[model samples]
Target: MPGMGFGIRIEGLSKRYGEGDTAVDALKDVNMTVAPGEVVGLIGPSGSGKSTLLKCLGAVIEPTAGKMTVGDEVIFDNGWKITDLRALRRDRIGFVFQAPYLIPFLDVTDNVALLPMLAGRSNGDSRKRAKELLEALDVGHRAQAQPSQLSGGEQQRVAIARALANQPPVILADEPTAPLDSERALAVVRILNDMARQFQTAIIVVTHDEKIIPTFKRIYHIRDGKTYEEAGQALH
Candidate 1:
């Protein structure tokens, strides 16, 4: 099983752009941990270093100094220990953006299966896995539909399935429910919680949407490039 260790861990993580007087500190000694099978919320105002933190965790950018561990592997210590960040991301981390960003030309099934295929799985096995995920997400009916043909909720569900396609230990979701109505937004969170438990995937949802804030069992609030944790209503 993947994610055998703690899902994701960061200690003294900091990111700075530029130098000297012009230097901007986007993150300051940030610390966080997400256990396997847990879903947590990351809430912050604009310019609170939320995006920077996400980039660091996603391996899109490097941190000036930090220690990070994904599952049992320590990927960063002062600097990156892994040479192939792209492959690390592909095999270990799943991302769900605000938009579905599904391929326009590919049908829903292909869109979800693409990740596993890129990871070198056989095409047949990849499509089979995608179909199973679609069925789990209740979007199997739309497997043959194009992205443009699905409703906003359907597209997001497909996106979630794609993110889980690799069975990555962790999932990073950025404003995933921002475009949906309150009803749909909560439904999406419910689905995330279910997926997290089912796959033992640690999920961090970054959002400012007040509609679903109270649903999390724990919330991390970031401000002035720092983070603080608080208990949530745990509505789910």
Candidate 2:
């Protein structure tokens, strides 16, 4: 499906919390598209529906109304199209959070290999995939290290490797650079861009970090439950 040039396609996406007069419309008729190998930015002020939109896209919360196509699969249309959301999330979507959140008990290789292993891949193959991703991300040297043994940047790189282990067509990065300094933050964004192109996966980074905003070639700004698409810098 990824080879067919599918990415993430959303149309009329909306989310409402509660009902009646007290209902809060978190997202209002939002439409956005990201192509394979593209790295796009999603930015907004605090409480501007960014988190709500992310949750919907990530399948963490059900949207009141919307249509969503991930890769070539129509996961949501007014309601869910797929029955196993847990499998869908685990297999089709990858996530990178503000913190690395690597398993403390696992080594770097096992940390990444865990995702593929959970997907039913053989242990040998999973670790092989993990090593490939780690090498691509330049964290191969720390493959045997524990999570706590790595630096902040190294740990985040491992997290990213883990996210890619399943070879998902889409990656949702939620403030991935929030914990880093200016230099490290920009470096992480660069890695995301390179990896997106390398693996032909679409990436949407939701962040408020000023240091990484200008790095995006395209940006979507959310405000008042609505979205406004804005062009950012040209591809670097």
Q: Which ranges in model 2 have alpha carbons more than 4 Å from their true place?
A: 1-4
Query: What local lDDT score does residue 127 receive in model 2, on the 0 to 100 scale?
Result: 97
Model 1: how far residue 62 lies from native, Å: 0.4
Which one is best on TM-score? 1
Clashing pairs in model 2? none
After superposition, which runs of candidate 1 have C-alpha atoms over 4 Å from their true positions? 1-5
Note the clash tally of each candidate.
0, 0
| lDDT, candidates in the order shown | 0.95, 0.91
Estimate, for each residue in 1-236, the C-alpha lDDT of model 1 and write its tens digit: 12356889999999999999999999999999898889999999999999999999999999999999999899999999999999889889999999988899999999999999999999999999999999999999999999999999999999999999999999999999999999999999999999999999999999999999999988999998999999888786
